[model samples]
Target: MNFDLPLADISTDIWDTKYRYRDGDVIRDASLEDTWQRVARALAAVEAGQEGVWAARFHEVLANFRFLPGGRIQAGAGTRHRTTLFNCFVMGTIEDSLDGIFSALKEGALTMQAGGGVGYDFSTLRPRGARADASDTIASGPVSFMHIWDSMCATLISTGARRGAMMATLRCDHPDILEFVEAKRDPAVLRHFNLSVLVSDAFMVALDQDADWPLSFPPGRTVGNVRARALWERIMRANYDSAEPGVIFIDRVNRLNNLGYEETISATNPCGEIPLPPYGACDLGSINLTRFVRAPFTPDATLDLDGIAATASVAVRMLDNVYELAHFPVPRQREVARRSRRLGLGITGLGDALAMLGLRYGSDASLDAACAAMAAICHAAYRASAELARERGPFPAYRAESYLAGEFVRGLPEDIRTAIAAHGIRNSHLTAIAPAGTISLLANNISSGLEPIYAYRYQRNVRRPDGGLTEYAVEDYAWRLYRSLHGDAPLPPGFVSATEIPPDQHLQMQAALQAHVDNSISKTINVPADMAFSGFETIYRNAYALGLKGCTTYRPGAGRGQVMTADQQPPAKPCCELPGAD
Candidate 1:
């Protein structure tokens, strides 16, 4: 890979403003190379011996943006920022009481203060108008409490703290779910939260049967019932109109979870890439696929499978080192991270790589290429973790028999599985596909994880120190690279934008990759504004049928159109915002 390549203007700006470490008018990272070196040094310090050897290897993987770590890791690692290396956490379950709620809120505040996004499952709270057993007071319900959290996040952002990103999930069976589904209808409410409904297998069955579904609480308290199909339509309509709340197939998420036997998951990190149990946390990184492409815009184009495998191996080790170097916001979060040692390693530049290889984004050939690339990364990461376990010890929570029996593990290559059985794996779950928005931008505006190019060129608003927006022109990395090579030439058929691809193709791309991902994925199925309601609903139905853990979609000129329009401009947040992201 060419490490001497110059960064695009936007990439340079992103690095200088968001990632470069500085102290009291002194810049710690004088250049992009310095930033990579700083992070490499910090992570490699965790190695027992060969710190110098590992630092060089880590730096090599990071150079030329071949591997992009999560924004939190890029900014906080080797810095005096007093922040977490982990990007996000599923906070401990809300306790369903005033004290419990406030305590959880404070924990969230602290975690955010430490530069981590938070997720919460609000299903435990009683329904609105329900009387508390102990105090006999009318409960304000979960949505009401979410307002407090929303305000808190806004307050943090106001103070120039890390950009506030949060996910709030409510169970479909919750009596107050109706209100939760409509919470974002006003467009001005809960601006800080990304909401999702926890759809259970039972709920899908009810919808399939067109039967009445009970809205109930714990201990068999039946609040009321509604027509299942009607409720399902409401959810689809809410998303069709407002672009949220997304749907999480909660049953599938838990059942397919590698650690399902040990924990129950109710919420996901801000973008839904990782569905974590209470107090669960994970760090993230991506393999830039464009770096592995052997040829460009020619019949000889091919992916360097071996190179991808090698990078993935090094990336796993680097992320594992983060566990030793990071500071967790809470004791319980640290405990969970140490026990699981979860890492999210995915791919970026997928769209560009596909186009560079002369393949369409959603075609069968592209799907095959995607599966091949993801498989190499996934298997390589597992093998590396197993080797690390042999060198050090496995994660404290690893149980050889149960872990191997997991649905995802059972499908791994026989050799990888055999290795895990012999030497326990260092990480419970190794692969997840994040939105990778900010880091992808920092990597010269490469295509994000498993997503097509959002646009070839668009205006991006960068927030200034004075709280104003500065508009800058941004171009897709592959487009610029191609233009530089073949000036004024028309793009190949493979070059397509997010909206240019069919909605089913977007879902298909995600589904194809999901088979290899042990953790959930964060992908937005982009639908044209003219797409029919029935067609829109099929995307979710198909996602469930395809066995995806969750689904999020974005429709231009939808209810959020007031904020996100159809002029090809990216969303104020294209995906999950990274810590310190604009």
Candidate 2:
């Protein structure tokens, strides 16, 4: 376990400040390897009588950054903190009455306090202007209640040095659907929440047929009606203007769920990766795809599919163990997690992996490669889970006959399906593509989950001691590899950035991976600044047509903060240099 660890300064800094384990004021772990060992040892302890053997295997996966757990896991595992290892959870159904609403709110606050993100389906609450029999007054609606959850989330800081994240979803047919869609128009509203419109199959069908859609509340009350396409356009406009509310194909998510017969899913974890039932938690991890690339920027470059499969198998076992060892915020959450044993085992550095193999992201070759790689990961994960089921026992909620009949399970390879049928499966759901934002950075700036490189190189501004800014150049993983192989040469055609690709291509890539993913995939279609409204709307429609569970797009706008500037010609220098120059 002792060796020379070649660490990047940026990666080291991120680990030191964010993930490394500490007790009181004492830093117990000093290096990235130390953190890896800590996590490996903690996760392995769940394996009865074989902690050492599994700990060594887990350490091997973590050593070279081949596997990454979510931030909550990285920070809470192997520590004394009373936080949950799961990163996110969908709260149980919120009742329409005042008492029920506040009760759910309390649950959300408690979950957040335990370093877990939460999602709530606000559509359960009655619409605005509805009658309240107990108070004999008007009901305040779902949006108002969402505001209270937002404030609660804002006040509770997560274990990893940030406020908790939340997702608020509303059904499209709700009477206050229009208000929910427009709630984020003011930039200040719902600051801590990510809004998503649960577009049912009925709504999409109505839009396709140019029919009027009813706006209704509970107990079969129709409050109003509007053109379905018109409401769809409003959603498009709001997203175009502010990028607040994303869309989820609720019908599709439920239809394809492996546990659809047992549970009803309304909302998803914060990033829309795992759409879960009430009190259900998201146990997530990612296999670093870039690490499995055998060769880089050469004719012989190839992806090591077997390597990926092995890593994914180990990752599934580690994540499943996480649920056993970690503490839950409440008794109900623990019960839900143990019954189903849901885990999201995904891949990161996909874009970088594609580039290393000399494949352009979004191209046909890249899509095929992504599909093949994801298929291998999913198959291996399922097999591993089945093996675990045989050794220990299937999850409490496992329904062998009903589970095998699920849409996703039925689509798996014959061998995998047979294995599951014979041995049962430990985790209800496996394989989701998470954003992996910080973990990607920690992994030496590899391209994030299924996203093309934003920029190969960019100048970051750093404040100097004298209060002036200094420019520091940052290079992406693929860019660095390409430069090492062919110095100063122009980037190959494979070096396609996010903005260079079309929006449709992004959806295609997502759909390709989504086919094998049992849960959802977290992907953002990056549209250009000058893209037309019509073009933007097509992305969502295409996503639905492609059978994706959800769609999210990012278009740089007025309020959107700039992260990195693309490599293009700079504007002319200022008319006169500032007085603080050398």
Give the TM-score (vs. native) of candidate 1: 0.96
lDDT (Cα, 0-100) at 120 in candidate 2: 93
> What are the per-residue Cα lDDT tens digits for candidate 2 across 473-573?
56687787777667799888888888889998999999999989999998989998899989999999999999999999989662344435555735222
Off by over 4 Å in 1: 1-5, 561-582
Clashing pairs in 1: 241-559
Residue clash pairs of candidate 2: none
Task: Output the worst ten-in-a-row residue range by lDDT, candidate 2.
Answer: 573-582
lDDT of 2: 0.83
Cα lDDT, model 2, residue 392: 80
Off by over 4 Å in 2: 1-6, 158-161, 459-473, 565-582
lDDT of 1 at 567: 40
